[model samples]
Target chain A: MRIGDLAARTGVSVRSLRYYEEQGLLDSSRSPGGHRHYDEEGVDRVAYLQRLYAAGLSSQTILSLLPCLESPSAATSDSAFDRLVEERDKLVTHIAGLTRTLESLDELITLNRKRRAASVADPDSGEPGRTTQG
Target chain B: MRIGDLAARTGVSVRSLRYYEEQGLLDSSRSPGGHRHYDEEGVDRVAYLQRLYAAGLSSQTILSLLPCLESPSAATSDSAFDRLVEERDKLVTHIAGLTRTLESLDELITLNRKRRAASVADPDSGEPGRTTQG
Candidate 1:
């Protein structure tokens, strides 16, 4: 498919696709008319790239780690696999932290809802203030 | 506390704290001697800002949403709180996707470890290829 098709399929802008190619995070072949063409694999590859970027991994780190993600069974050294495991551990820690944040948000939202309800029930009670959570 | 102290307390770089202030995602007061001073509230504020950044929220979006996060019970219009809930919902979706990726990585790691153990047991089984998982 052409660049436009890839962009439409992935929901990424054409400029970002080109930037990914330039950063070596993606690849394309030129057509007979010199337009960029991406194969079917490009779809999943772009999706993976987007996930890593969303996780706050730099393009450089993602580029370095792509091999571990792309090839699961090609004979890599134990140390290489170890590094990938380390990266995974980092992700685990990150996920845990985000989970905590989500919980905090949930608590705050619940408290606000209750307060809002009370205020609605009794308009003369003065405005309910922000919940002070440490 | 001073900028450096805040950086130390929050584990964020002093430069990044300055950047956050410049982006309007954080605020600091200046002492009479012209040095930036941050209050106790700045600690949690910086931590929250960092988490938002890690979750891929741009500074602009975070700046706009700060009020919702900072004040849970202050009388915000229904629309304002609705926008915050929308953002939280987005984070929930992102967390779900990352969980899937983490699971995928776990499977790949397990497969690779099994393959490595098998190769160790029999050096002449011909190279085991990647597990073809769709």
Candidate 2:
């Protein structure tokens, strides 16, 4: 597939795909006519890259991790797998914190919506005054 | 408290605190001695900024969200709060996805560790030969 197909499949922009290639996070083969072509595995690889980026991993870090992901044997040596485990643990903790914060934000939104509905219905004299509604 | 103190309290580097100030995500008053002074609220604000960054939000996005957090009234107008609520929802979804990936990585690490231990104990044979452990 071409870059456009990869972009469409991965939901990443063409510019970002090119940038990822430049950053060594992705690679494509050159055709005889100078066109770039990606294999079927490219879709999964791009998806993984997107997940890593969304998880706040820098492109350089993702690039380094990609080789380990592709070859587990290479990853297991020299405690590389250990480092990956540690990084994943930290990511899990961070995700949990974000989840809690998100829940609090959702509760705040629900409360705010209820208050808005109450104010709209009454239009006056509810809680203190309209000046301090928020 | 000074910027350095806020940095220490929030676990954010002083340079990043200044960068956050430049990005308008943080605000501090200047004393007569030309030093920046932050209130107790600054610690919480900086902590929130660090979390937002870790959650993959850009400094600009955090900056826009900060004003809404500081003044809920201003946030309520034109559905500004609604946008924040939606963004938070997306963040929650992203965090959940990351959590799942992290768990999968943990399982992979555990399996790899067990396989390694078995390989080391026997130095051969286990699961259809040791040619493919990973």
TM-score result, candidate 1: 0.83
* Per-candidate clashes, comma-separated: 0, 0
Per-model TM values vs. the true structure:
0.83, 0.77
Per-residue alpha-carbon lDDT of model 2 for A1-134, expressed as tens digits? 99999989989999998998899877899999987799988888788777777777788766555534655442246455666676787787787878766765665566556656666766753433222112
Interface DockQ of candidate 2? 0.28
* lDDT tens readout by residue for model 1, B29-113: 9999989999898898888788777766788877666555666554655766776677778889988878877787787788777
Docking verdict class for candidate 2 = acceptable
Best by TM-score: 1
Best by lDDT: 1
Off by over 4 Å in 2: A18-27, A122-134, B22-24, B71-75, B121-134
Q: Clashing pairs in model 2?
A: none
Query: How high is the lDDT of residue A8 in model 1?
Result: 100
